[model samples]
Each structure stands twice: as structure tokens, then as C-alpha cells.
Target: MATAKQPVTAPTVISVDDFLAGNPDERRRADAGRLRAIMGELTGEPAVMWGPSIVGFGSYHYTYESGRSGDAPLVGFSPRKQNLVLYLTGGGLEERDDALLARLGPHRAGQGCIYLRRLDDVDESVLRQLIERTVQVHRGVDGGSGR
Candidate 1:
């Protein structure tokens, strides 16, 4: 199972520029740039900085059973200090049967997240499929719509 490396505690909020600025390593900056490209290609939407750290694409609103409702990005990603957090608001991998997800490098799938230590560790094809599927989900192209 893939797990996130140690994350910066308190999760320092970061603007896009600040995030890039903090990465002294050119590789990190390149990784982020690659991710942005993939997100745009997969989602067919322009990426938006949802908050300080999260780069999101698309949008939707949801209401919980508790009557709590909020707006969230349809698909998004975050470059945490320790790892990359792929926000799959659409859903998560089920078991190890899914071809696309299985191809993704070792990863731990939660209901709404896919954690990765590095971009090089993941299979580009699989990652692209996941992102494409997720974008469709967010757009209600599949049976289930956004929550």
C-alpha cells in the first residue's frame, strides 16, 4: 500500500506562488508543472486555485444528511510537503481489480483521495485514466453525479 510521507504539521496554507517559491528544487517545480498539465488535459477544464494549496478544476455543491452543505472542487490536487494528494471527489478505487487504478503505482485509496509520494512512482497512463474518469463523474456523465 502506498502511503503519504510525513506531512508538514498544521498544513501551512500556501498560495500558488508561495508553494512554488518554497520549492527550491527545480524538480519539485517541474513535478508541479507536469501535474498541472495532466489536470488540465484530463479535466478539459482550467485549473483553479481553490485555496492556498489546492489546485482544483470544476466545481459542485453538496448537502450532507446532517443538513450541512458546501461547495467543493470536482477534481483537484494538492502538493503537500511530504507527498501529492490527488483529490478524487468522484470516488475511489475498489479492490485491486480496476485495470486503470491497478496500474497506478502503489497507492492507498480513500473515498475521496489518492496519495502518492512522487509523480515518477506512478504510472502516467493509469493516472490519466483516473483523472479522466473523475472529470466525467464530476460532470455527471456517468450514472452518479457530484455529491
Candidate 2:
């Protein structure tokens, strides 16, 4: 018999305030607060402590071709020592609008995350749009395959 595997990162009962307060620098803490507000308003979900470090908003379940499955945040961010890393949907960044990325200010996009050194570096409206897209993708509201 096979056992049901659990995801390595899952939501915890940790207080969102407490987790956010742990930011190592003042800038990160402030940026985290701004993100909490933006993501909260966009997702209509309160921030939750996902795993030990991520301040996540909503969640979605996913399965791969290998049959491995787990739940993940619809949108989230982690204020690391060096960068504010955003965990967008697994559908990846290719689906994002090219013009938007071009106007997103100085930042780097990963397979499913966007990294920025400072929130002040980007256009807030564009960031919000990217986040809104992630929420839409995870909720299956967007007509894409949500790959």
C-alpha cells in the first residue's frame, strides 16, 4: 500500500504579523506590509503563514503528470535577506504580458517567481496587475490552460 505524501510546504497556524515582523531589515518589513495590503485586497484573503517564511494569501491544489500533488498559495511573497521573492502560480511567467514585464522596472523573473530588490523599484500598478493575473489563473477564472 502506498502512503499519501504530504507537501513539504504547507500552511501553518503562525500569526501573519509575527512572521512578517521577523523581516531582517526595515525596508523588507515595510515592503512586506505593502505587499500584505496589495495581495490581501486583490486576493480577498487574509495573509497566512505558509511554511516557515512565506506570507501567503490564497491557495490552490495542483497535480503533475507524475501524479504528484500538493497545495500551494495562489499568490505569495517572501522577503528574503537580499530580495523580495514573489511566488506566483505554477502556470509560469511566459503567460504574462510582455509589455507588462518590460514595464515592471528592474526585476528578474524565474520559472514561477519574480524577484525584486525593492518594492519601490517597480510600478505598483503593474505589480498589482501581475498579482491579479496570478489570482485569476489560480482560481481558473482566466481562460488559459493554467499550465
Candidate 3:
């Protein structure tokens, strides 16, 4: 009589290589590779595909004040044709230092995401700091361990 509830967690299914292969454009593929390497090294976790596009690293569980809850990647990136979307969770951009972001080259931030047209468009060191700080904050919020 009751319908089954859909799973809240987006399981990591597609492998990094397989997902990268799905990108037909050579440049996009190369960008995905760079993102994979950067995120993998920052989170110290294996790269996992979230849904069809996002390549996520570590994951954490979150519950809203309204009671809905779900697990999401601590940090991730998607090699979209138009731009690279970086997912920086835990604390939003306002919580992060402004100087680091200023040095991050030409990019835009929305809520908890950073968008870049290309890897060369941003400073890698600043990007690394952003990812590291995001992961650390989320890990602390989730008790220092990812699911």
C-alpha cells in the first residue's frame, strides 16, 4: 500500500576512468583528469562519480532543520563543456577567507560552488587551499570521518 522511499544517498557508481571516457572532447577530458588528480590528492579519497557528471571525493551526511537528510560529497568537480564546477561543501564561501579567493584567478562562486572556465584560468595553489579548507571543515562537522 505504501510506496518505497527513494534512497537519499547518491551512490558512487561510475569509475573515474569510465566517467572520463564519457567525455568525448579531448580538452574536457584533460580538464577532468586534472580535477580528478587535484581532488583525489586533497581529500585523500578515491574519486567516485556522483550521478552522471560530478566526480566526487569524500562524502558526509547532513540533515536539515526540517528533518530531511542526505549524504553528499565533501568536495567534487564536474568538467562541463562551458566550465568546470567545483563543489565546496561544509561552510559556504562567505565563511572562507577573501584573500585566498582573490588570488584564485578568474572564477565565480555560488552558494558552495566555484566555477572556472579552465584549469589555467585559476591559481592551482589557491584552489588547493579552498578544497583543503572545505574538506577539513566538513570532516570536523561530521566528526572527522567520511562515509
Give the number of the best model, judged by lDDT.
Answer: 2
| Per-candidate clashes, comma-separated | 0, 0, 0
Cα shift from native, residue 90, model 2 (Å): 2.2
lDDT of 1: 0.70
For model 3, the stretches where C-alpha displacement exceeds 4 angstroms are 1-9, 141-147
Q: TM-score: which is higher, 1 or 3?
A: 3
lDDT of 3 at 136: 81
Q: Worst ten-residue run, lDDT, model 2?
A: 89-98
The number of the candidate with the highest TM-score is 2
Better of 2 and 3 by lDDT: 2
- lDDT for each candidate structure: 0.70, 0.86, 0.79
Please state every model's RMSD to the true fold in angstroms.
Answer: 8.0, 1.5, 3.1
Q: What's the true lDDT of residue 104 in model 1?
A: 88
**Candidate 2 residue pairs that clash:** none
* Candidate 1 lDDT over residue span 11-72, tens digit each: 23345566655776676677777888888877777767776678777676667667766667
State the displacement of the C-alpha of residue 114, model 1, in Å, after optimal TM-score superposition. Answer: 0.8
TM-score for each of the candidates: 0.76, 0.92, 0.85
Relative to the true structure, candidate 1 has a C-alpha RMSD (angstroms) of: 8.0
Q: Write the per-residue lDDT of candidate 2 for residues 50-142, one digit (tens) a residue.
A: 988898998887777787777888899999999999998565485555688789999988778899999999999999998998889888898
Please state the error at residue 88 of candidate 1 in Å.
0.6
lDDT of 3 by residue, 52-132 (tens): 778888788777667777878889888888888988854447455478888999988877788888888788998998888
